[model samples]
Target: MTRTGPVEIDEQTQLAARLRLVVGRLHRRIRIDGRESVPPLQLSALVTVEQHGPMRLSELARREAVSAPTMSRVLSALDEQGLVIRTPDPNDARGVQIVLSDAGAAKLAEVRSHRTALVARRLGRLDDDERRRIADALPALEALLVDED
Candidate 1:
């Protein structure tokens, strides 16, 4: 690639675009395999519960960047699928804390395993130096997504 502009787009920017394209293709392929996992936002909620332990519906909604009603609907669906359980919040009689059922945990584990295997296979094709670059960038990418507020 030739640097033709006053502001040169570095290798990092080009790699980011390539990574996005690869991710998009992988997501499409996964969907075609009848995986039918929850949407991105719902997956985030599942992860929040998994990482932070059970939380109230409103808290999950806030953390997931969705309206409370929308969270309610998502929880309802997950509940119907036996993926989540709602327990009365110990702190409040009227509130409920969403918790993952055993089934949900297993499902999440399976999905994560599948995704990891897919990425691992792709990375296996790359040279050691290329894989090392991605390994080095993981922390920076994670930091960029971290919430400081």
Candidate 2:
């Protein structure tokens, strides 16, 4: 049923849609510019482990919001690449804890440096006022990520 005269969208909804598109596109551009070696999911999982320190497979899976099987596959690939090390959880003999290897830390640093440089270069193209506008919006933008619960 297409009875389209003029579909009304509230201001907040319009802003939400635009924000989502812009953020997604910017993230893609940064990842592409970084020439990431690992796929995004694996990279994200690696970052999570690095940030949270060594954790059990279930914990990593939960933090990454991925199923255990999927996280296992990602970890297996990472282990093959020497980006992560999995060791038996001392408290739970049956479970393994994931640790980010030195190689993984180096990889994350390289990717972050490249992406930061790319964004800095792009920001340099903008005028002073334009840059200030972005800086001013940053706090509000960051607030959007705060978990309500």
Candidate 3:
């Protein structure tokens, strides 16, 4: 059942190595293009709030792999920047929720739009065949992130 020469395994390993490099480069490029007033980590937290609606300081901290106190500081900065607001949690009257302000939403949108435009411009330079190849790989490329572990 097993074939000799390690062709399949070798090819897959090489592909994985190259893919990692390319993905990292692309991420760096996007980040550079999307630079905003907020730091990257804080921007990520803001994006999380926008994506998942309001969340608690502890919940956001946990999701961001940071301590609650650290998250509180981040939230404080965001609050000062008018990027987030504290609202009373309806279900837990004693708790507060962190919600992205309209300004924060606009900022996030602008950053993402800039990043997307960067990629779109790069993609436009590729030939039709190369573009099609990238497009054809979308499903398999997307599947890689489905179950990371």
Candidate 4:
């Protein structure tokens, strides 16, 4: 629904009621479908390294919005699993940059594939018209993220 800068209470109330329930259910289901072999923090750290690797441990921690100590523990778990490695930073001899190992990339890909497959399988059960309606809502759904920082 179109609205000026701030969404009025009535419109927002209706939208929020519908969106919270649907989005929460999908999020939980998709999360369950992903791999649980690694702990959540470790898996998230591994994916972070894979996506924006060759970055300083401190930088990664900052990007993750986590304390340096907390991120260090996450990295330690990932390192022990051979999912990520810390290389000497090119710019600073005292600093280390985190990068995803080959195995880490593979694991991340596998987890993502499982999540995608689960969602696709569920969507496939919908009738053609139902599926079409969902497809039509994709743009609006995606647009929701644009408001986020």
Candidate 5:
């Protein structure tokens, strides 16, 4: 511990720094296509619902780390726009689950495609080495993201 040539970086700090840089760059690129219209938390909520199948209001709110009332308003807006559907939960007589509508699924696909195209355009400009570096880093990045404590 005393004679180290170079101090080892803390894993948490390194991961945080990398995520910040990548997400920052990705957001900048996404903004160019008017994709920044939606707030990050709202977008995250939508993505959560889309990926997690139907979930109760409280469950969605908990996952997004927002208050139930706040999530209720968010879901209200999404519902009014026909982006989410509320269904009675099969296991709970008094509870409802929010699910993505067909329109919502289609919109999500379109938004993803736009982001993918933006990244693809930039990746197309990079040299082979840079592209390979990104591809090689993806698996480790994914594992870091999905690993549970």
Candidate 6:
């Protein structure tokens, strides 16, 4: 059911709203703490390439849920920064594949390490019970990302 007024909001709706705000704030905090030379879109693309390995431009665009032209621009910026290498696709001679360069991997690792350290420090300030509660919630948090289909 949908509520037209705040007077009738449901528990689930309130939980969803609170979770979204907290997650967004945490994400922004991490990004601010781990600000890198690469822009957010470009960094996300780089991470995708790293996860999926070398893939054709079309495949990368599809995985990233972006148009080919948009992906192309992101790749171009990464290429200019020497974060990604465009190599001729062996399977499709006419196509090019995107590969994460050594620099890209290092940058990703560095960003993650910084963010993790920041989180660790913050978590350290919490009481043991609070810390355990968050740890226990990990499974549920991860489950939230599962695709329902």
The parts of candidate 3 lying over 4 Å away from their true place are 1-6
| CA-only RMSD, every prediction | 4.7, 5.1, 2.5, 2.8, 3.4, 3.4
After TM-score superposition, the amount by which residue 105's alpha carbon in candidate 4 deviates from its true location, in angstroms, is 0.5
TM-score list, all predictions: 0.74, 0.89, 0.87, 0.85, 0.81, 0.89
Quick one: ranking by TM-score, best first? Answer: 6, 2, 3, 4, 5, 1
**Cα RMSD for predicted model 1:** 4.7
lDDT of 6 by residue, 76-140 (tens): 99999899999999998898999999999999998888889989988999999999999999999
Root mean square deviation (Cα) for candidate 5: 3.4
> In candidate 2, which residue pairs get closer than 3 Å at backbone N, Cα or C atoms, i.e. clash?
none
lDDT of 5 by residue, 1-149 (tens): 45433334566577789889988877776776645545666667789998899999999999999999999999998888788899999999899999998978877787788778888988999999999999998998788678577
Report the C-alpha displacement of residue 45, candidate 1, in angstroms: 1.4
Candidate 4, 17-115: lDDT as tens digits? 999999999988788776468777777777777777589878888878899999988888888888888889889899888898898888888888888
Model 6, 24: alpha-carbon shift in Å? 0.7
What lDDT does each candidate get?
0.83, 0.90, 0.90, 0.84, 0.83, 0.90
Residue-level lDDT of model 1, residues 1-149, one tens digit each, is: 55555344576688789978976887777655536467766676778889989999989998888899999999988898888899999999998899999988987898788877777887899999999998998998788678899
Which pairs clash (backbone N, Cα, C closer than 3 Å) in model 6? none
Residue 10 displacement (Å), model 6 = 1.4
